[model samples]
Target: MGVLTGRTALVTGAGRGIGRGIAERLARDGARVAVHYGSREETAKETVAAIEEAGGSAFAIRARLGVPGDAETLWREFDRHADGLDILVNNAGIGTSRPFGEIDEEEYGRLFAVNVKAPHFITQLGAGRLRDGGRIVNISSGLARTAAMPQLMAYAMTKGALDVFTRDLAKVLGPRGITVNSVAPGIVDTDVNADWLRASEEAWQGAAAYSALGRVGTPADIGDVVAFLASPDGRWVTGHWLDATGGSLT
Candidate 1:
């Protein structure tokens, strides 16, 4: 049996990219995963299928975040499949490639709405359903710590808020033996970054050079870090920001 044989995990935005990697990893570790998607139901189904094909358990749930009653809608669907929660991976998010000056009110509002508000309320409502000794892992980014790109200021701000949420939530849920932490990744090659990252050798090398490891990160790298935090091995580590950036900050 794997380390998380009896656990139940919910991974938001598991339809694609980093979230898909995390969902599959958790399932492989023996957790019954709930793959949450915003609009890509088909992609979420693909993630669930991949997990099952690998002898893991997973199901997909659809709920668009950043809207009215989004958290409520998500839990309502969650209740249909599972009775309790053991792990919650808040990995759903959006990035604004727009520069600071060009970001409109609607764009900024949507960023905070989906990245900040959705996760905040999702955790709040999920707290009651999460059993004692459970885990909460927030997928953050390196931009929150370093201003590497000025164009992603708003995106960075959202992650910064999430980091704060991780610290504060960890304390609040400590009594229940729940551990809350943030995992920040740097220059990961996900579908979202495929266009620019694969555009040219120069673009690829430039992104790779940002990390001390001299290579761009993969979704699995971030997934494994999250699996560690979700397992018993990470019991004593809570309320901290983990730099899974391949030494990018260094």
Candidate 2:
């Protein structure tokens, strides 16, 4: 049996991308995963199907974030499937590629709403349901520390806030034996970056060069890191920001 047998995990935005990878990994490790998707219900089902096909347990839950009553709706949906939570991965987020000067009020608000507000409320509401020694992993970005792209200023700011939340929440939840941490990823080769990353060989090489490993990161890379944080082996690690950037900051 896997290390996470008898545990329950909830991975937000698991419909696709890094979230999908995390969900699959946790399921592989023997956790009953709740694949949370906003609007991509079909993709969420696909993730669950793959997990089940591999002899793992998983289910899909639909709840659109960044809107009214999102957290409540999400918990309501979650309650329908599971009774308690063991791991919570807040991986749902959106980015604005526009420059700082070009970003409008609505756009900025939307980014913060989805990236900041949603996770904050979701965790707050979920805390009671989470058992002692539960794990909370927030998916942050390396841009929160380094200004890789000026156009993503607002996006970086949201992640920065998330990092702070990770630190503070860890302290508050420590008494309960719950560990809260953030995992920051660099240039990952996911569908979100597929357009430019696959534009040309040079484009791909340029991105890869940013990492000391000289390779683009995959969804599995981030997923494995997150899985460690969710596992018992990571019990002692908390309130820290893990650089899963493949040494890009080096």
Give the number of colliding residue pairs in candidate 2: 0
List TM-scores for all candidates, in order: 0.99, 0.99
- Residue lDDT tens for model 1, 60-154: 99999999999999999999999999999999999655789899999999999999999999999999999999999999999999756889988
Single out the weakest 10-residue window by summed lDDT for candidate 2: 95-104
**Candidate 1 backbone collisions, by pair:** none
Per residue, candidate 2 scores C-alpha lDDT tens digits across 53-103 of 999999999999999999999999999999999999999999554689999
Model 1: residues with Cα > 4 Å off, grouped in runs: none
- Tell me how far the alpha carbon of residue 130 in candidate 1 is from the true structure, in angstroms, after superposition: 0.4
Give candidate 2's error at residue 110 in angstroms: 0.4
